[model samples]
Target: MKQTNYYLFDWMDFDESLSKDESLWKAYTSTEVKAVDGDIHITVPYQKQVLQEDMLADTDVPQRDYILILRAYGDSIVRMFTSMVDDEMKDTGSYMLELDKALTHKPLSVEFADNVYTIKDNDGRTRARIDITPYNTEWWSDLQPGPQPTIHLTVYPDGNLAKGVELSDDHFSPPRYDALPIGFCLTEGKPDRATVSFKCEADECFVGTGERFRKMDLSGQTFYLKNQDGQGVNNRRAYKNIPFYMSSRMYGVFYHTSDYCRLSLADHSSRSVQFRNDRATIDTFIIGGETPERILFHYRQLTGFPPMLPIWSFGIWMSRMTYFSADEVDEICDRLRAEHYPCDVIHLDTGWFRTDWLCEWKFNPERFPNPERFLKRLSDNGYKVSLWQLPYVANGAEQIEETKANKYISTPTGGWENAAGTSGASNFSTLDYAGTIDFTSEKATEWYKGLLKNLLDMGVKCIKTDFGENIHMDATYESMTPEQLNNIYSLLYQKAAYEVTKDVTGDGIVWARAAWAGCQRYPLHWGGDSESSWAGLAGSLKGGLHFGLSGFAFWSHDVPGFHSEPDFMNSVIDPKVYMRWTQFGVFSSHMRYHGSHKREPWYYPTIAEDIKKWWRLRYRLLPYIIEESRIATESGWPMIQALLMHHPEDKTVWHIDDEYYFGRKFLVCPVMNGNDRRDIYLPEGEWVNFFTGEHFEGGKWYRNVEVPLDEMPVFCRPGTEIKVYDEKVDSTDDIDWQKVKTLFIE
Candidate 1:
């Protein structure tokens, strides 16, 4: 085993008692916070810890590094990076998500008072400012008094924004922040962890920590910022963990660190929104937008926008958890042709690679004997192929041994413990046997892409890049720790896969599961591992809505949830739930029918026609869907637009998490309950029901609307023109949009 000579992270996740652990201050952060040349530069004395034995095994370090630097771009957006520096900023290469520096600038005006720095606009009003109560290590008392210091950056949403209104500061922040403070605070003993608290204002709702399932109002929920394959619908932890939150306060609090963080907005801290994580340098961003859309727009501008997906990708995809053989896939394709159920792509799950799924990337000779010919057959049948993949390489796989020979696989460091310059518990990464790709290594990235290129050459149209939640420990490319690469692992992996796929096909589409802030650059990530229940179905909706706010341009979900465990071998899905899921799935950004239980229309013979009609309708909406997809690429608006994203002024839709707009117009209400009639909100203006053609005025709730198992509520806005193709085709291979009916209704 390789050895590491760096401090390991030693801390527990979400341990609430840390906030009260007031030990005599052994570590102190002395600093000078100031603005220079249109940017804020904060310098701190670096602390070097004395180790007992090996740096890897040392539980706690006496000192850690700290550097705080802040820069504002285009006014309201402020970038703050808190880094522990042994030397200076390390040169990390040209990564896509790197901050774009501003050439032209407007210097920020500041008023300094003791330890407080207030940033103001040229109009002489507070835009955003920080208050830092420095810790005093020299203070001596009866038992040596410990200094408890708090650091907070509070911004006014309407305070003289660069491109927005110059509303007064009194418009946003109420007097409640004093009682429920939201800011950053350092705890004693745990030098590597910091607790961040935000005041829970009246009607304060938090969203977007990357694809969570709880209610839209995350005010009383504890969300763990660690990605896991959580199959259960109610699991608090998610598959994609981005340390960011968009608030009703019109300001966003984002903690940009790679450590596993505990974001608690639950009753545990009912008064404040907070998160606790192992201390490294925190590079947090406080984004101020006038509206939710503006917040999301600037957020994507900071991270990165997703590339445009090909038009055909907008059509429906047919997928199942496991398709053992090529013959089975062909049969499904043949059946779809016989039944006239339109599908653009067919996804063969993990088992297609190998039964053990070691990710060898070799065709299972027994199942897919002649892989190239089989792929050609799929193309000949007018179907695009999508294969499943994960970053982890199982230990006994031949590729693992081969990569080990080439030193391509990352050294197993057992989480942050064995990582450089940090101490952490062995809690986050438990998949020890599965080795990960060392993407930072140029040789390794090319070699891995070569293997994927072989598949692309075999007619695989898309790649399902899955399971990148874990970034291997120990040293990484550029001598950085896994703590530094943890959150970014998925981003880099997707980039490599995307680059390779784009090289083969004109454009690439990856159905990714795990993501970070900038991973949206790779479009089409699915809600990870959901069960087949009404809860899971509804949970998937929340995931898409939240993820859309997180800046992903496009998102997909398993039509009828993922697994039905206890009966893994014999999976079964409820017919009504499946029907409702199909109705909602067809209306989503990218409709993909995926689950462990068989998703074939033949399986549900009773509602087979309904399922076919919905699938055909998905094909019918291809023109509109493709246009919306192009708009997503151009404007960074997700195809599945959250109700609140388009209508933030309508407060009723802010809390309504279940229903959302399909594109720029059509309202889609997913059926979650047993009743044939459910409540649907038609926002401001006349709306026409797709089924009844009855007109209704918006700005009011229409309860008990007819939404059977076969159909959910889909409403079109008045005076908007929609082009519907006269004929529904099974594929996008040959389509004539000229032969479409244009409906302009009022």
Candidate 2:
């Protein structure tokens, strides 16, 4: 759908934010205007804003950041960045990635005309206009009186802003040692981590904080943007932490900082949203669009896009905790053939090497006596093979000494120094065993990739790039402090593996665990270890949805979580949970049936028929999935999208996480909490249930949408066209794509 001009709409999208009583658009207006050098400065008095509250007049008011001039990025974009200068005029530069350095910087041309400061560029288009106003008086910490300067941006063609900072009057503030001092702020005596909130309805919410396991709409919750490796459904620490999020407010905000930050949506403040980065400067990009999907696509232009994968990668991948020996692998292949189940890729997880969880690239001779013959046998059985490995060289391994000898190991620091208030103190999961590979050193990356390449030559098709989150913050790097490289370490590790694989063969992909902004440059990523329960299933889906909105298009999860560990809470999943999780997985971009326990359909005979049915459906719809994968590569839209992305105008879809649009056609609502039914909200159109072919009108809720244990609630929207294979195919290499039948619903 083509985007509509936002200016024509009577209501601003942000009005749906939790702060419904006070509209951000209605409360503030242009007052005074001036052309300051190359920028436009417009000011608005606070008597019209929150400062007007009668109840706050007696109480000591907190200092608020004054709104300043606006900068236009050529035609389609505008930006706001704070250059923090202290009393001495000393400044702290931005600590985030300098993304603008790579883009075209079009200088702004400012002109004063008709009492309004007109801001334009070389193209002679009036991008924005600034009208200044008398500043409002603000009370500082010592009850000092001061006037606050204000600036407002008018995105001429109507395309931006609604995200700005407001300081809350609070005595308690977190220590930000890692951030350059900014108590002395940009004009307004705002707190170090200041805030700008959306006055939205209760229904408005937030989505992308990469790889969160809880609910998708993070409206009232406060999560610190620190990359701590955590497990379980409740733990707040995440393996992937990218400080970027898309809002139901119809805009995208990304704080370009590697430091700790906090974003609150009508949580602490009764009527406003907030943003506080650990650093001194608040450098961010606010992208606007008619729909969340288009905003995401524009956001992708700043971050990187997901890489394309080989066609065969879209097929089913089978794995267990170990698949230890060659004979065990062969027996599994033989059993799949006996059951007439379609299997394309088989993974040899941990214990395939000399020792379990050791980053040894060599295959264990005891387990696989002959790697060559085993590879040939699997190839003959129509299977591609993948091996597992991580970046750490285990302490006792022979390669540990060898890796250190060659200066590849990360040198230990005296201790964890440079603690960043909360991140360094609150979360501690320090690994004592091995040193991480120093990827900043090109020699180390090449050495590790060389080892992986040697294995790829032998038999392994791809490596399950795992466990990159637990880097030693004290470890030495050639350039930046290890603390600076902490969150992005996964990218360096995954990039080495991906680039090496791509160099050797024409194709490469990694089923990785963690990521940052540009990590999507590597194709595939999977959810980390999850327990075997409905909550875990929901968490995996939630995490995928969150990660997808962050520009990482392709994502997968442990179909039924690998819930068995010697020390952790572990158990085989209830058959019902496994079946339901598999139903959701079947529609995902990449399908994989994996777990610590025996995940084979034969092992759980009760759901065997259901399992086979879903597996066959995966293959039958392979051609359609492959085409969608191609579209995803071009558009940066995920194969699985929250219903909110496709139907932003329909407020009902904003809160739905259990059901989402799969590949732009089907609304898949997986049964959660072991319920035999669920409530599904279909957005504005006609849709038909996949199983019963019963049609229903959209824009209404279907209560008690009966979803049996054997069935997942999937509905096809109108104007859908896709391919269906006539028979179950064992491997993607064998399927005749030209012969598959196509189905179109108009």
Q: Best by lDDT, which number?
A: 1
Tens digit per residue, CA lDDT, model 1, 1-746: 12222111211232223345322111123356666765656554333222221111112535333555555656556655554323233213425344435412345567788867777655565656565655444544544223222335555533644422111111012211211121122345445554434456657678888887777767767676876655555567677777788877677766766667777653353455655665534555677777777777667766766788876787778888778898899999999988888877898887786554556777899989999999898788778988887776665567766776675767655433442322121122232344577887788889889989999988888888877776556544444467757777788888889989999987777889878877888777888777787888888888888888787778888888777746754667888878888888888888788877788878999999888888777777777787777777756478888887777767777788888888887888888876667888888888888766778898899887776576678888767777677587878875787776766756
For model 2, the local distance difference test gives 0.67
Which of the numbered candidates is closest to the native, going by highest TM-score? 1
| C-alpha positional error of residue 175 in candidate 1 after TM-score superposition, expressed in Å | 22
Q: Write the per-residue lDDT of candidate 2 for residues 632-706, one digit (tens) a residue.
A: 876748988888878777767667777887787778888877768888887877898776777889888889867
- Which residue runs does candidate 1 get wrong by more than 4 Å? 1-34, 42-68, 84-106, 111-126, 129-153, 156-158, 161-190, 196-200, 266-271, 354-356, 413-434, 471-480, 737-741
Query: Looking at candidate 2, what is the lDDT of residue 203?
Result: 64
